[model samples]
Target chain A: MSLKNTEAVVLSQLRLGEADRIITFLSPQLGKFKGVVKGGRSLRCKMLASTMPLTQVAVWFVEKRTSGLHLISQCDIINPFRTLKENLHKLVSGLYLTELVEVATWEVEPDEGLFELLLWGLGSLAAGERLQAVLRIFEIRLAVLLGYEPQLSFCLGCEKELAGRESYYFSFAKGGVICAKCRAGARGCKISLGSVNFLRQALRFQQEKLGRLTLTAASSKELQQILPAYLSYHLERKINSLRFLNLLNVRC
Target chain B: MLYTESLAKLVAELKRMPGIGNKSAERLALYILGLPKDEAGKLAQAILQLKERIFYCSRCGNITEVDPCTICQSPARDAGILCVVEWPNDLLAIEKTRGFRGHYHVLMGAISPKTNIGPEALRIKELQARVSSQQVREIILATSPTLEGEATAMYLYEVLKPLGRITHGGRIGVCR
Candidate 1:
């Protein structure tokens, strides 16, 4: 196997036997992959910050031609995102982003948009942007890229445009907005029409200037419930890190 | 697939064990078959006996054959100072050193958001009860220095702060 290199965002690391660790990372060039970082868990390990989840690192590894764990030789930190870990809420939200990325995509398949989004999301969090807004954008954009994007432009049931400032039902099962007439006994939460419009605009917002668009407390609360529940419905389970994020009282 | 019914059953059973993959389970099953019949019987009996004997201590959540566990019932232990640890293995490590005379409260695990484990799933409630009921004045948080461990310590401090002194006791990492 030849030495391969990629700029990756750390997703998670599980401790292996004693000093070894199995690091899951997402790369712009290589998608998601697990690499064995020898001595990564040791007290003397210098590569600790590089392997920390949510950090960006330039990694060199011996890629196995067969489908097995890669041997990571060197991983240098690109952006540690250390500030994100200082606060409990930010740490869980940052982890939520990586967990979303890890589960949304398959292994060894590159998606440049998702990779860039991951970097931008972590940077926003580390730079002290509001947690709820960053998380909402990250979740929606992730679903869009992964082909589970929730329907917000129009009502899925009535086949009419979702209009005005009234509240509408956003169904996780139906994957879109439901008009009041068609929303009777729907299996989803009632989201404000304003929140739906905001979600749509936020999705189209340029990644570089995401933090500029401030969300109101009400809109943030609505999107926080709608987007995650929808994503969890598609993924067939709750996002584990999100519950912890909620408990730390940093949620929308 | 195995050649015999019993071998197949053995492989299936061994595969259920932690860290035993299908291949490893098969290897272990074959190894067991190669052993003398009495030795194989002894191994099976040992596993059964282990399950019947070992249980979680009700007081601290540590794995023990006794209900309160030896440390909880020990007259030598200083009950006024409690050391809250993340896991039973952590309690064992602390005991191996024989440096601490205080009682322990095993959390079973830390508050790891990535793993969906919050304060609710841990033994923090029992720790709170111990503090309110017992003379737990000086509480030492002996969790790991990992982010999840530190987060757990912080949460514990919040819950126990009103009750007693709270401090962390893990080896210093590269980060403060």
Candidate 2:
């Protein structure tokens, strides 16, 4: 049961004892796993290419019987994600995707469909799609995958059949939108009608079709405010990377 | 468990050091005991002295004993060209190469979101103040090539671009 051979995306790596490195990988079959690469820090290390932030690699490792780091016997880079390294925007997107995968999934839990989502996220990012839009999609999809899909129906207060053609108040506490009549002193941010539709479309959009779907600036801004609030409320903590990305948006 | 109380204390303190395991720490504690009394005392004094004397330069954020680091105080270095680095050690590395003649601004760390480090956490405001105070023509953004480093460079570039009609972007000579 310790032996492993699968395609994995290298998430993060940290230095271990002198010449070794402990690499975190997200594999389709294994979900997330950590293993040791002996002599990985040396100059002539052939497995060097396999451990970059978002690289797709073929890795072979033997898991220990006890709860300890597995021994990585062999690894080869299947896809280097060269574009992710070359373009600064793509690189940040890549790092964001890696961090999302790292936090969303548990180690060796075989997270159902998370590996596929990660692959799609990285592939779309490297292909030069809109950076903010790609992240929005990834964030929404990740939340859905983890079974915390935000309620996108009628207002929590009025419970009326709301038309999706106007702006509505989204409350983190009520878990969804608040009607205009009931929005008196609502403790939440406003979500545009377009963003609500975009979110619905994103939830159902296929991975291959994400590249064709465009995210307008208004929609992006609304999603930027609403999605993070939803995630923080449901996940019970704010993600640091989201804050960093928001800072970039403010400055850029 | 068999060691004397003082020896045990030394080993525990030594074990707190990075890359020092229990065995290496024990060996270091024993080694220190064998050293001359004056030398051992000197080692303890040196560690305490470093903590007391070395401080960050308020303007540039580099480690220094003086108020402003030597690089910030030197007149020979070009004030128009600022070289931003992630850490003090990076400044030392560039200094060792003997190729650059610009003043340095250490960010203390790069933009690492996973670690909860952002522009607000870094010396971004100080860097901005320096940019405004000096007649800088072209900033040499010299953060490392890692993801966080590049992100920090780009973050600075985007923030600095709107302030003036100056050149922007990092990776040496790719100004706009």
Candidate 3:
């Protein structure tokens, strides 16, 4: 069987046999992959460096002509995400992002948008962007890519265009904005337009340009309150890793 | 026209995934067919490799190719301390912290009467044997903060109390 070469991000790794490892990766070209790195568990093996969580690497693997686990022939590290590994808070946030991506995207499906978003998110986290803001943006963008993009332009119920209103409620259940007129009996938290605009920009902005947009302390906090409910509302359950990110005392 | 045997099989497999539904599965199946051959081949290979290469560690029950896993083999780690977890993923969560300096024991699953998974269904007996045979001082029960996890921890506590000290390990402790 011929070996296939590709670039990938190590999403997760598990030991396979005595010396082998089952490496799960998110690749730019191939999407999500789980391959076996022979002798990865041994100290002398160089594959260990490439088969780590969030490590970007160029990899070569052989797929048997028929069908079986691909054998990871070699891997060269691209970026080890040193800052992410060094800081506890950063590491958890990074893991949270990985988990989010794993859950949001389909296995083996080449989602260039989702893959790029993940790479950008990891870079942003490594570059020390505000953790909360990064996560909020990540969630908003993920929702957009997955086709749950919020109707930030208008009241989802009435289709009335929303301006800088005093207060508004985000309907996680309805999957969009609810103007005050429709929020009386809505099943979501009330947020200010400042927070709503921030949410809107998070969805609309390019990753590199995300740095230019800023959130006030209040808007940031309001976003903290809204995004999770918005995600859980659409996803139908709270992401388990999100709790770890929230519980840690890292200021965004 | 689309409700053929192949489409049905694709839907069945897609639906087996954690959160995908029938509609989503159908969409995914169609998407898969639309992909370029190489892309589709890579996807298929990834799934096949995960099942082919990934297996639970015989010693700790964590997913690893090796017998004792990297964490278990590290001489720098404190062998005297063994952190018991409900699943391999929990072991990964603990490992990501790089805080714990010890070994691990994966139970493979928790004791849930509701799920009909009893103590014998888990690696509890192996865990007990490991504690007794090894120079172990503490067993940190790092299970999920759930009903099943709590029950499993309690059961372990009862079984291990006589063997060693039943100390509260902290948030990173033995009991949940």
TM-score of each: 0.80, 0.84, 0.59
The CAPRI classification for model 2 reads as acceptable
User: Per-residue lDDT tens digits of candidate 1, residues A100-125?
Assistant: 88877889899999999999888888
Docking class of 3: incorrect
> B132, model 1: CA deviation in Å?
1.8
Q: How high is the lDDT of residue A168 in model 2? A: 85
lDDT, candidate 3, A1-252, per-residue tens: 887999888887665645678887888788887788878877678776677777888999997545446888999999988777655466667777777777666667787888788888888889975877888888888888888887788888678887763467888878878878777786877778887789888877777899887888898778877876677677665566566456554323
The 0-to-1 C-alpha lDDT of every candidate, in the order given, reads 0.82, 0.80, 0.76
Deviation in Å, model 1, residue A172 alpha carbon: 3.8
Candidate 1 residue runs with Cα over 4 Å from true position: A15-19, A39-49, A148-162, A173-175, A182-188, A250-252, B1-54, B65-67, B164-176
Every prediction: chain A TM-score: 0.95, 0.91, 0.91
Q: Under the 3 Å rule for N, CA and C atoms, how many clashes does model 1 have? A: 0
Best by TM-score: 2
Candidate 2 on B106-130: residue-level lDDT in tens? Answer: 9998887767787888899988887
What residue pairs are clashing in model 2?
none
lDDT of 1 by residue, B1-176 (tens): 44589988888888887678889998998999899999999998999989999999998888999888999899998887778888889999999999999888899889888888888999888888877887666777788877788778767766766664334542211011
